[model samples]
Target: MLTLYHNDMSVCSQKVRLCLAEKALAHEAKHLNLRAGDQQKPEYLTLNPKGVVPTLVDDDVVVTESVVINEYLDDAYPKHPLKPVDPAERAKMRWWTKQIDDSIFPATGTVSMSVAFHHQYTPEVLDELTRQRGPGYRARFALLQKGTDNPNFSDAIKRLYKMINDMNVALERGPWLTGEMFTLADIAYAPYITRLDHLKFLGFLDKNPRTAAWYERMRSRETYRAALAAQFNPKYLPLMEEKGREAWPRVKALVGLA
Candidate 1:
């Protein structure tokens, strides 16, 4: 039996869950409340030293990173393959996953923390976060404390633009990122792009119609709906909308969208 330690609302967890659903794999779920700092606990740290969610324990084997876990599942299960057969397309899939981790995830984090995290965090939570993590994480909390954009905000927006345009260009090949079939690349980017839609600064999509179309197609998938509905955190939605509305104009201006 596979056991997964994950947070429902964590985008990374959502990706892994979607992959599991697509492959029809049955697994035990252990939900971690990220807001309550469950992930920073010692036991979880033992499983994943990074103190992150969506750690998959397949018998004795442990997979920590979400993308890697998805890949592992595909290889281990083999009933439903999420990776491409062609070498070039597989390379493209890996590159797309890299963008999800290296660029899109950071941009989503910056934008999300900037807009709403400051509104929800208490002093105690902030203190815990600062104490549990290192200088880098504390620095991010500092920016959130200020209730303003981090210095990375501009860079994140720019990177989002680049990622969107790149997706659009690849999508011209039609139906999916690497080509005809939906692969891990699509599963990887789905949540981050949806985060942008939720934040309401999706001009990137407007400028890139193909990606928008791709998103709609993604929405039609059973796994997409299941992932979103299963993980939609109602507790955060009100604040997300409140602050997102308050910050959208500034965000739009910063990203240079009309």
Candidate 2:
């Protein structure tokens, strides 16, 4: 009875898909072709003003934003509850979820965006594309220059490190980020962090064995595995594979793909 608007490869959408799958809830999936700008169409825009993927329509109620959707699903189902009863533990889950989103998501986006732009257009053409797209997009487009921008790269790297260290500390608190039990927090963080690790931009965990172990544990879950196996542009695969070629062995070893 739920209709989910999602792109198979989107980390945000994967979050929702993982939650729904874990709950064994059957839902209709309408895959948005983001590359074709389907999300910007009038019909889809009526469902989500922001025109983002992973929009969930439950009966008459509509929910956008992956994190919010995760909470909504957990609250709605309440059978196999993802959030624990303890207020403190729930608070910790929310906190870590925010940390994961704010930190890992952006850095990975920057890296991926950089690669995408380069693959799609020449520098001169890209410059024209940015000009036509406007400042908001231009700023994102400029993420390609992160290496030259010390402040930018430093901030990204610092946030990535903090995300790893924070999770490591959370592990010290207990098995899961919130404490003993696994919850929505793990589901939220797994896709983005695993994608980054798969890309080998995970120096944060490289030196921290605790976080490395935690990374391994998170990827072992069926939900996480299912999410990673979602579809994407086959062309992008070889590029991601080639770009992260050096990381292949380590990534495979970590995820048991080896």
Candidate 3:
């Protein structure tokens, strides 16, 4: 039996869940409460060493990293393939997914924290949250505390803008990120786009109509409903929506939309 250790609303976890849903695979779920620091506990650290969510176990075989896990799933279950059959298109898919790990994912976290999630903490809670992190995460904690004033915020906005602009250009060629196939590339980006939607930071999409349309097509998929929408955390929504909307003017200005 396949077992997945994941958090309900984590983007990485959502990516894995989308892959499983796309492939129609059956698996057991172990939910982690990230704010509660469940992922940092010794047991989970043993499984993922990095103390992150969406760790997949196929029988005794363990897999970490969302992109790697998705590729592993496609390779392990060939019935409903998520990767393109063409080599060039497959390479394109990898390129999109690679950018996520290299920059987009980190930017999402920065933007999300700067615009919304930082508001979720009180002074005491923030202290506890910061104390929970290891040395490497101190910079991120600083971003969370400083919000959009962080020096990195503008760069994060630029990265996300580049993502949307690039998506619009690529999508003009075909319906999905990697041309005709709704491959792992599409699955990989779904959550990040949804993050912009949730945070109301979609002003970047205003000029990128094709990327907007592509996002709508993605949202229309059953896998999106099953994997992402169904997993929405109620507690986080109000804060994300409220703070996200309030931050839009600044975010829009940062993206040069203003």
Candidate 4:
């Protein structure tokens, strides 16, 4: 039996769901409400020590981390291969995902927090999140406290813009990041692109036709609707927009469009 503990809007969770959906794998879904402190509960912490979303339990085996879980699904299932058969291409896949973690992930978190999330967080919520040991979450708490006046905001936007440009350069190799075949590399970056779009960072897309094309193709995939778009939480739309629009000008100027 396969069971997954995940949150609706978590990009990591959506990656797992995308892999599962692509493989036509059936799994029990235990949707956790991260906002309600569900991930912090002792029971969940036992499963995922980091108190994060998208834990996959396959019979007696458990998997944490979205990238790890997606790889696990491909390895365990093997019917629908998400990894490249060639060693070089597989290595490229890992590099793509790693670049996202090292570059895109941090900026996306800061942008999301500096805009929408910081507005919603109270001192108590910030304190609770602040107490969490996860580096990214703790970093988010710090950014949240910075409010919209973050000095690091411009740098973060530039970093993401650079990453997007690099992605476009990578895609110039072929239709997909890993050539003609779509693999975990595409899945890894797609959700981040979606989040950027939501934050009105479409400006990044305009300059990178290849990345823009790849993202459009991703949207047309069935797994995208089931995995990414379906899980989008519209509840945050109002704040994401209000703050996103307010922040876009500064972001634009940083990227030299303004």
Candidate 1 wrong stretches, greater than 4 Å: 134-139
Better lDDT candidate (3, 4): 3
Put down candidate 3 lDDT per residue, 1-258, tens digits, no spaces. 999999987999999999999999999999998877788899899999988988999998999999999999999999888888889989999999999999999999888988887776666765665677655565667766777787899999899999999999999779999888789999999999999989988888899999999999999999899889989999988888998888888889888899
lDDT of 2 by residue, 1-258 (tens): 999999877888988888897787889999987655678788998999887788999999999988899999999998889997999889988987786566677766655544332354456655655565566865665556442242454455455556776778778877777877889998887777766655555655765677788778877777666656645446655665455554345433433334
RMSD of 2: 5.1
Best candidate per TM-score, number? 3
Candidate order (TM-score): 3, 1, 4, 2
Q: In candidate 3, which residue ranges exceed 4 Å CA deviation?
A: 122-140
Reference-based lDDT, residue 231, model 3: 90
Each model's lDDT comes to: 0.83, 0.71, 0.89, 0.84
- TM for every model, in the order presented, reads 0.94, 0.82, 0.95, 0.93
Best by lDDT: 3
Which residue pairs show backbone clashes in model 4?
Answer: none
What's model 1's lDDT at 238?
Answer: 75
lDDT of 3 at 204: 80
- Compared with the true structure, model 3 gives a TM-score of 0.95
